[model samples]
Target: MKSPSVVMLRRNLKHIARNPTSVFNAVLMPVIVMLMFVYMIGDAFNVGVNYVDYATPGLLLLAVCYGLGSVAVSVNSDMTKGVINRFKVMDVPRSAVLTGHVVASVLTNLIAVAAIIGVAFALGFNPSASFMQWLEVIGIVVLLGFATGWLTVALGLFAKTPETAGMAAIPLIMLPFFSSAIVPADKMGPGLREFAKYQPFTPIIETLRGLLAGAPAASDVLQALAWLVGIVVVGYLWAFASFTKRA
Candidate 1:
């Protein structure tokens, strides 16, 4: 027998294929931001390192952050349109529905990341890291995406409608700006700078930057992994409880 989660994942991917615009919508803003910052005014924002190197890590993560928008809206739509209820009434495992959304979101965002990187390369953002280094970067990004995607899933379940779910996902989209994504955290005002240093996106972005630059750091990687793990565990518990009790 095929896994319930795999079956549901295929169904959702088909739905995504039919509506390609959703993927574009999620990635558009991040792509625009990357272009604006890297091409339009990259020279204006001086933070010591080459702007492309700095911005690429943050921009890729930003795309993943915004990619949560689609997942949230889709999850909310299913709940509102009786699909989750239909699954409950059937013999399907409850967790499969959320797992399917999560897997699809990660894969979609990974593809979006690849596209973003290619565009970055076109704009002269070449990274000369080893194959394993590139793999590590991908791994970290996917882990962070899983964390954010699952949390958005729970938020979607909590929403009154798909609109609210999209709104709920806005924080993730805004996260990169507050972190060491676009600029170094030390460049901001004291308060905002301190906040940026400790936020979830900062270490993750910094870790990716370090990895891509071929000067790997351990602390940020640990911090990013810790944050991802924490988010996934909490989000999973909240989503499971909410789904079992209410949906």
Candidate 2:
């Protein structure tokens, strides 16, 4: 028998393939960040390495943040349209519905990352990391996609409407800008700089940059994993609890 999760995943993927705008909206911000930051004023950073190398990690994190909004919207639409309700009545595993969406969203985010990085490569973003570093980067992205994507799913579950779900996710889009996405955290004012430095995105961005830059990232990597774990625990609780009540 086909896994119920796999069935739902294929169904969600079909929706994504049909509605190409979903993918475009999910990826647009990161692509813009990569293009504008590198080509426009990359010389302004004064980072010792190539600006592309410096900026690519930040862009990848930004892509994860931006891409997850689609997860919220997708979940919200199903709930709003009574599709989730129909599934609730069926004999399928209840968790499979959310699992499918999460799996599909992660796949979609990976595609967005590849597209954004492909553009960066065309513009001369040379990666210096070995194979292990590359694996670390992919692992982080997958973990992030699941962790943050779950919260986005919760947001959709809690929202009364799909539009509200999208609006609820706006903070995620703005998070990277306030973090270390485009510029160094030290460049900000004192209080903002401190906030930026300790915030979750900053560590993830730093870890990604370090992994790809051949710089040491042990602390940053640990912190990033800690953040993802906290988010997953909280998000998973909220999502399943809310889903149970709704179902």
Candidate 3:
């Protein structure tokens, strides 16, 4: 017999496959932003390298954020529609349902990330990382996605409706803008620069930027991992607590 999580994973994947609009919505905004940055406004800013190269990693983070909104919406849908209650009555593990959503989210968002990268390449984004560095990039991206998946799941469970859950995710989507994603932190004004420097996304983006440039700093990588681990732990606990309370 297939595991409950596996079964639920298939169910979620099928739903996503049928509703192509979700995927399209997730990918569209990030692509437009990348194009705007690379074409209309890129030359205006100087990051010392090709603007495309400096911006791709940050855009990739943006794509991940957009994709997570769907995860929150999907989880909220399951909660509101009584699907989870049905699973509980059938003796399914509650964890399986959340697990399924998180895994499916990571898988779908990865495809979205790949699509964003492809668009970046078309816009002259170039990564100088070695094969090993590329693997590290993939690892970090996956880790970040998984951690945020649980966080979104918790948000979905806590929300009164899907729209509310999506709204809750808006802060996450906007967070990259405050980070060193599009422009360097030093280029920003006083207060904004300090916030951008210390925020969670800054270290993650910096690590990614360094990796793509083939010179990742140990400090940045460690900070990124610490942030990911903390998110995963907190998100997991919060999600289950919310599930127990709500379900």
Candidate 4:
């Protein structure tokens, strides 16, 4: 017999499989952005390297951010539709309910990441990372997706409706734009530059850029890990608290 969380994972996966819009938003949107950057506007930006190489890491992060809305909406749907309540009545382990969504989300986001990477390659995005560095890149992306999955789950739980839950994730989607994703933070004006530098996503994006360049900074790696840990901790606690109260 499968564990309840595994069963829930399968259930959520089926839901995602049936939702074409979710898949498109999660996967294709980032690819489209990459195409736009690499082909259209790439010439205007001078990042001291090929724009494809410089921008792919940030686009990868964008893929992760774009995928968060579906997770939030899915969780909000369950909450608003009483699926969570039904699970409670059936004696389902409460943790399994949220775990299913989080795991399914992480798995799906990874597929989105892979698709973006493929598209990046087709557009001439190149990285100098060795085999181990590639693995590290994968690990960081997974950690980011996992951490943000819980955050979206929490958002879903807090939202009164699925639409609102989707809206709540807009900040997340927009956050990458404010970071060093498309351009270096130094290019920004005074206040915005400092904000971009200290924000959570910048370190993560920088770490990814460094990893792809084969020289990840220790500070960036550590800061990214710290942010991931903090997000997971806060999101986990808030999700369970909301679940307990709402369900």
Which one wins on TM-score?
A: 4
What tens digits encode model 2's per-residue C-alpha lDDT throughout 12-52?
Answer: 89988887677777677679878888989998997777888
Candidate 3 structure, TM-score to reference: 0.96
Model 2 TM-score is: 0.95
Total clashes for model 4: 0
After superposing candidate 2 on the true structure, give the runs of residues whose Cα lies further than 4 Å from its correct spot. Answer: none
Q: Which residue window of length 10 is worst by lDDT in model 1? A: 20-29
Worst 10-residue stretch by lDDT in candidate 2? 20-29
Off by over 4 Å in 1: none
Clash pairs, candidate 3, are: none
Go through the candidates in order and give the clash count of each. 0, 0, 0, 0
- lDDT over C-alpha atoms for residue 102 of model 2: 85
lDDT (tens digit, per residue) of candidate 1 on 48-110? 777888799989888888778778889999999999888988878988999999899888888
All models: lDDT? 0.86, 0.85, 0.89, 0.93
Task: Give per-residue CA lDDT, model 4, range 1-247, as digits (tens).
Answer: 8999999999999999999999888888898998998899989998999998999999999999898899999999999998988898988998999999999888888888999889888888789999999999999999998899999999999999999999999999999999999999999999999999999999999999999999999999999999999999999999999998898
Off by over 4 Å in 3: none
Across 149-206, the per-residue lDDT of candidate 3 in tens digits comes to 9999999999999999988878887999999999999999999999999999999999
